[model samples]
Target chain A: MTDSSQVYVREVGPRDGLQHEQTWLDTADKLNWIEQLGEAGLTYIEITSFVSPSWIPALADADEVARTLKKSPGVTYAALVPNRKGLERALLANIDEVAIFLSASETHNQKNINADTESALARLSRVAEEARQSGKAVRGYLSMAFGCPYEGKVEVDEVERLAERLFEMGVTELSLGDTIGIAGPKQIEAVISRLGRMIPLERLALHPHNTYGTGLANIYAAFQLGIRRFDGSTGGIGGCPYARGASGNVATEDLVYLMQTLGAKTGNDLVRLTSSAQWIEKRLGRPLPSSQLQLSKEEGRCL
Target chain B: MTDSSQVYVREVGPRDGLQHEQTWLDTADKLNWIEQLGEAGLTYIEITSFVSPSWIPALADADEVARTLKKSPGVTYAALVPNRKGLERALLANIDEVAIFLSASETHNQKNINADTESALARLSRVAEEARQSGKAVRGYLSMAFGCPYEGKVEVDEVERLAERLFEMGVTELSLGDTIGIAGPKQIEAVISRLGRMIPLERLALHPHNTYGTGLANIYAAFQLGIRRFDGSTGGIGGCPYARGASGNVATEDLVYLMQTLGAKTGNDLVRLTSSAQWIEKRLGRPLPSSQLQLSKEEGRCL
Candidate 1:
């Protein structure tokens, strides 16, 4: 089992969460939110994505957001770069790390990036090389690692094959995405047990969605299997466009609460994290799906 | 670990869930819902409570609901009884089982039942005796077993003591409730490990809320510790009136989904359960907090 004392959480709310929102937040608001998340003790925050503005008008001002935000000391700011073009913009913005993503399922890869798996890997490899040449770290995201929407059940062998390819392309860490939120603890165990043989457990992170309310259970199972890193949104924002009716990423506040109760230190302040989530909830003009945020509001507690 | 092959789920939606709803459902609708639950493969359902109508107007027609609903063979119908008076009403209705409850925390007990732990236990012991004499099984619920809102951090020793007292009073089973939804996996492990020593694991159950999003994780932890019985509400209805900001009990649909995914047979039909939840959600004129229900609705699938 992994050491239960310390855990690393990467906040992907600003980028992944806001991308799916119909209401576009102002660039300044995004920067302020990112700064507040850092102040709340998040060591790593994915501020925005470098995809084409035409594709995601919500995060169109990513360059401005990355370049103008006040970067907190001791915090690593990252951004999602889809290709070499996105990587060049990330390099200009001096992002601390660049995240590239593809899908384990062939159908999902075709639908998500409009390219097959091999073609998408070829593009991400070029981006990884260029980002590394600029002395920046590269993180890979393997979507549908557990299940896919178009496809029924994704094979463990397919996930391992794609993960190994990403690692071979110099990707330092891979965050396995349960894009459809269809996984449970047993599925997590089955997949992680297979992957752990060929990949270092420490280099793996879990990105689970709470669509069917099994997100935290899956995380707990992975933790038991010695997986440490996790990714979550501040207010449980973000849903895959392809996965119909899917909830956002597992809420970061909820994840931190579980980790802390499990005796794992996440270096996050619960009160401040709740405050950040509430602040963003107001900005979004709609309630975010964080259970802790809802409870705090119901209790009328400042936290 | 408990036999991971089979699990017993007790549905508390009609009783605990409706008692907290602001809008009163018609007695006919309640009967219809209860029948549907049985048809959906729930073998144990808490149909109503025998408390005074003034205390819970939503369940004012408890006798009518209990007496008029069609009882399925092999399905046990239960109701919550506060004292000898309530048990008298329950016995008149010919309910199959009677459940009595108190709190692990002193303040919560006073606020919830208008009696301290000692007085509440004295009253419930009499209720249990009368119910058993009338040929009805008795189930005890210990609320705030994890933490209390009025008094934070309830002692596990206190839970053990109260549980032992109830078992001594001839309670065949005791369901430990996380009334405020403040527990995580570690707290579950801690509490169950202690309670398991003094009590038979099979006679213990977990009734968790989803307020802080740790409900399923807590259930998973308890299941790992050999807990086979769980209490849930269909569509995740019922929040604590005393515990401010607390969400409803863990959703039955979500629970069954988790158990099935973990290779445990719940004997509940997912499609029928989702339909029941959706039907109630419509009658309630609001969405229930079930993740699986939400996902099914989002997908626009019949299930």
Candidate 2:
């Protein structure tokens, strides 16, 4: 089981949040936003993706983002690397951490990265090895671990098998992404309990989207089951571009408020986090879907 | 712990959902809305408040609303009764159940009902007795059980003492209201654990507001601790009139989606419930905050 005394929230706003939007923020705006998030007391951030710019034009300036981030002391900046090429780019940018991705469902894996489950893991295994040899921490993301838009009701055993393989391949952490947010507390408990038998709970993190409004509840269920690390986006940005009407990742302020109120030590300051969410939402020219940010601003309370 | 296999969702759209709104729904609209809710498979519904018209002019048509209801079989239709006078009105309207309200915090009690804590309980005690004599189910609500807007954090012992008094006063069910939505899972666990020792789990229910976006999380926490009954409003209507930016009860669709997805039988049809939410939201002439309702309409999925 993971540590019960503390929780680490990895802010994925710059990468996960920005990737799904129709609008794009230039490199300068991205830099300013990332700096604000860095100052907001995030201990770990998924800063950008090193995948081909042609694929993710929104984060096309991944190299610039990695190099320009005024690396905050004690904060780990991680970037997603699809393969050896992306890993080399990350190495050039001097990234703190590199992440590789696969999926529990074969259909989702093929649809997401144009590879079968085995082929995707094979690619990530090589990348993970090279990234570890290069001395950068490696994180693995198992997308659609709960349910897939292409394949509904992902099996817990499949997730466990994939997770074990990722851990064996030198991934320091495995983030289970509920890509379409179809997870409920019961399913979360069942999945985490099954995975805990194969992997140390501390090496697992949960990244839930709020599609059915069960994101926070699912996260809380995981927390109670002793998973400490969580992935959230500021202002609740980034829905699954593949799933219709899927909302963004659970809002950072909402998660922070729940964790803080439950007496969990999250180090991140709520006031500063809200300001950063507000700033980004303004830049997006629309209101973000964060309830805590809205309440904290409208009510003027220090929640 | 409460039973995990089955959950009861008591819809409070006509009462709690509409009470805080600036716009008023006439008796005909209220009747139509309540009928829609009843037909949508809700086993329990809080129809209206039978308080003095001056106190809650929004629900001033309580008598007419109660009289016109089609009265679905096997459904418990309830109304809020502030005192003996209100109970008498409910009795005349042949309400299936009558609910009484008090506050765990004296300041909130005074501000909300213009009575001190002890005085409000005294009044409710008489109403509970009268309703019991008339063979009507009685529910007692303890507002601000988690926190109070006027007086910050409320003590667990204070809530325990209040719940005990309400249960002793012949209230069939006791609802602990997170009036300001300041509750976290730890506080919910602490409070429910203490109350569980004094009262049966079946007699206890949770009424959470989504002010801090902890509403569903709190409900999930309570559900994990064996609470089987919950109170929610359609389309997540109404905010706390006393607390700034305090949202309505956790939306019925959100709660239904969660419990149903968790494999707990709610006996409420998700598709029909969502249509009711959309219908009422249209009546209100604005978007309601229910993520489930919004997603169902936009995604065209039968959640």
Candidate 3:
């Protein structure tokens, strides 16, 4: 079900990354950074989340960001929408796609969105249907699919159940998130291979965090299993606000470098991708977690 | 030729990591840190390098460290010996093993050790023989085996040639180093698969840097190719001084995590290993590059 030769990297830095950051880039800086990411050949970018400002003040200007940013041809600008209100706001802003998320573990679901698994699914189902009816694609995110901080070692059957429900709700793709970054290659293989029996592999993407430094290896293991889509933050600058010790998502620059070295086409320019990371790092006023960015800063050149 | 059920983790932090560090720990701290490492279930540790004080002032107390560190029951204490003089010092210290290194690329060899490849190999040939004759195990490190800073992509043919020569010199095992941390899964697959045809895979190890963030993935690729031995630093603290932009080695805690997840026995307690990393991080007065260490510091517990 996967394209054996190509990888689709979805940039989540502007949404997932910024949401957890203490430093807030202004709407203008966010727009400019998103533009730089697109110019670096990232075709898919989750630009913002249409959640309540009180919940995530860092990305409070989601509507403004989505409506005002100039959309590039061949680039899909997505947004995370939590509920019907967020979806309405997203549709108003003409967002390209709407991503809805729930956790595989019940405790994590309640902790993350203040809803139990069943209610969260019911709510996301409505949101998914509404977004689809509005002629937009819906992407589902199953966080803590690997291991839950509250409930350790999420069962693969539970993951499959949630994933199937999302797919049944008319979602085109399901991104399995290692919310705490605890999954390794064995866990990736076990979960993805089990899930592959129930769904098309192409419809699945990996959203891995580098918390335990196994993100890339886990991604590689999934790629070997015919997974083609991956989620990465530009500077590896996002983690679950609820998952303690969860570090940044795998950096987009490092992901591109890994894909390129593995002989897969990601349509990303490494130098430009690294430069975009640098731009965001400078605005963040602290070093980002991406190894490529660190190397570039150290040597004053893209490796 | 390969052990499918076990992973040999060789700790190179004290030698390779401390050698590049800006802050030099006193000899007592180095000894204490190394003893802690051995107690944490690391069976092999390259404690320090017997290089000139002028070359690496940080590890100037190499002889003292090699002599003073309390050896654990199953631990093999090793040191990097540059030549006959270093080997003599190592022998006098009763080092359990002596590691000799040269670069696979001529320019890197010249820049790293101020000697050409052929001459460096010639010098190491004597060191390897002398170490073996002295009844200590001999380890050979081939730096820039993946990619070189000045030479870019290193030819696998050259790697094989150099590797065969080192094996001919009676070294027990050869560790191929990604000095710049630029190689990824494909390069690892290509180089290691080719070399496996010429030499026994069990006699080979991977010394990967996390510069480009593909260190664990590269190690995973090598492991899949029947490699069991890996070189890592406790806190991911070391890089090649000669290779610009080179970052830390793959963290020992992270490596153990990966290997354990892959169903291989590394005999390491992740908590103890991470605590050791934190211990070193404090003494260094800054964060080490290990993701596990960072996560532990953030969560106040080992992930």
Between candidates 2 and 3, the lDDT winner:
3
How accurately is candidate 2 docked according to DockQ? Answer: 0.43
Q: Which pairs in model 2 have colliding backbones?
A: B2-B226
Best lDDT among the predictions, by candidate number: 1
Each candidate's chain A: what TM-score?
0.95, 0.95, 0.96
DockQ for each model: 0.48, 0.43, 0.49
Against the hidden true structure, what lDDT does model 2 obtain?
A: 0.85
Candidate 2 regions exceeding 4 Å error are: A1-3, A240-246, A299-303, B1-4, B240-246, B299-303
- Could you give candidate 2's per-residue lDDT for residues A50-137 as a string of tens digits? 9898888999999998988788799899999999999999999999999888889898777778889998888888999999898988
Give the lDDT of residue B47 in candidate 1: 98
Give Cα distance to truth, residue A115, candidate 3, Å: 2.4
The DockQ-based CAPRI class assigned to model 3 is acceptable
The local lDDT score (0 to 100) that residue A117 gets in candidate 1 is 94
For model 2 chain B, where is the 10-residue window of minimal lDDT? B294-303
Write one digit per residue (lDDT tens) for candidate 1, span B186-230.
Answer: 899999999999798899999998888888988988988889899
Candidate 2 versus truth, CA RMSD in Å, comes to: 2.6
Clash-forming residue pairs, model 1:
none
